[model samples]
Target: MDSAFFSMIFRMKYITRWGLMRSSYPETLSEHSMDTAVLAHALACIGASRLDKPVDPMKAAVFALFHDAGEIITGDMPTPIKYHDPQITEAYKRIEAEANRTLFSMLPDDLKPYYEPVFHPAKEDEAYWQYVKAADKLSALIKCIEEEKSGNSEFKDAKAQLLSMLSSFDLPEVQVFMQEFLPAFSKTLDEQSRE
Candidate 1:
């Protein structure tokens, strides 16, 4: 039997919502995935410690890392297309679900269980999911911070929308992270710009 790890090495093509350097960020799904994974783990750990929630931080991180694995085959559909409208959004979600099912099928039987939870997460892990969603938004917010630092107004609307999404989440730890740390990213962005 072939080892399953080789299946994951296929180079994916993604259309980034963030534009190329001239106007926007040139983010890729792979880079975004890594950031989300780290943020997910940190937020989950912080939430568990602060809120007494029994969340598996590692699992959450893993989940976030692979959450968009389906995009490898389906490609990254921007939020504008994925959520153009209620009907369009629901249809795109169904497409994503179908794509994930297809991706799960490519894995060996032994690896399926290991990946299914990430490909089609359970509702029981809602809190963990929340953290991942928050991480996604935070990642975009960080991107906007960088973009704005580069004197790009393209991400200004994105920054506002991301902050709005961040504020909508009820997690105290996440809120605290936003409150205490997010603003500093701008300074960091500015300092890094000259580097």
Candidate 2:
């Protein structure tokens, strides 16, 4: 009879990120998810309105919001470990799938349907998923930019690698986001405040 499942998910803030690097500002899974959701929504909107691709921004946002929910169960695996090689990446994907299932099991039977789509969408929503992926990378790029701004040398190579990876996406929405939105992340507080 205990159906307070979401409260567990809400503790995503407890899952800290950048475990390997010294973060000037600590980031949590909750914060990353929120940024990913907002960026996904924005990218979806830009695609629909500007790039001639129609997508449901709200759906994309919701998908992004739950994209990292599996991290709550698996903990935040560092990217290097998660993608160290094809075998490791495939193994981690399986682990993540199980973790996602474990997360869904917490929901009450009646509410399972409501969250299932958010956790695992249908094939038709591939474009939405792609937008979420782009948003995730964009969020990471922003994090790298923030680290560089804090004068941390740790993220220097990460920023360059992220930029290279991002450019490979070749999605117009991703391109537009990089060109029109990403540059501002490099700005100073004074410059942002003035604008």
Candidate 3:
């Protein structure tokens, strides 16, 4: 039987993020996932190479790609409402978990074992998950930066909030990326090319 998995995953392009705010350029879930995956790979590399930590860059990238897969079913619940209180946060987590399970069920039985960890990360991969989380926040931070650079103040507060959240992460890899690469997001193409 043909699996609907890939087809359902492709619908990520139709799910726009930052739905509550006006954006100069709307970002799709696919775009966000790609951005997160790239960032996750970089962070993992930084950890393994520069920080001398054991991190599988490929795994991080793959995990990041599927990190928000459930959002397709949840319709991108706005963060404010999703995390307004402990009860709502707990409820949303349950809903998200169910959504992920539904997505997982779409895969062929033979492939289920391989994709299991992608949907529900193993406990041993906690360190890698931290990197994914940091990368996810970095993606949002980049989005906020882009929005502000586009003269949209709607994301200004979000940018600050993301900055604070990222700063709280003790991962030196995150700090390295923030310091070395993130600044380029604020520059013009010409300015970046000259540097």
**Top candidate by TM-score:** 3
Per-candidate clashes come to 0, 0, 0
> Higher lDDT: candidate 1 or 3?
3
Return the candidate ranking by lDDT, descending.
3, 2, 1
Q: Write the per-residue lDDT of candidate 1 for residues 22-117, one digit (tens) a residue.
A: 455488878888888888898988878877888889988988887777677667776666677899888878888887787777778988888778
Question: Alpha carbon lDDT of residue 126, candidate 1?
Answer: 78
The best-first sequence of candidates by TM-score reads: 3, 2, 1
Report the lDDT tens digits of candidate 3 across residue range 1-195: 889898889999999999899999999999999999999999999999998897899999999999999988888988888889999999999999999999999999999998989888889989888988999999999999999899999998888999999999989899999999999999999999999
Local accuracy of candidate 2 as per-residue lDDT tens digits, 36-114? 9999999999988998786889999999999989898888989987788999999888999888888888888888888
Candidate 2 TM-score, true structure as reference: 0.96
The lowest-lDDT stretch of 10 consecutive residues in candidate 3 is: 74-83
Question: What TM-score would each prediction reach against the true structure?
Answer: 0.87, 0.96, 0.98
TM-score of 3: 0.98
Query: Would you list the C-alpha lDDT of every candidate in the order shown?
Result: 0.77, 0.89, 0.93
RMSD of each: 3.2, 1.2, 0.8
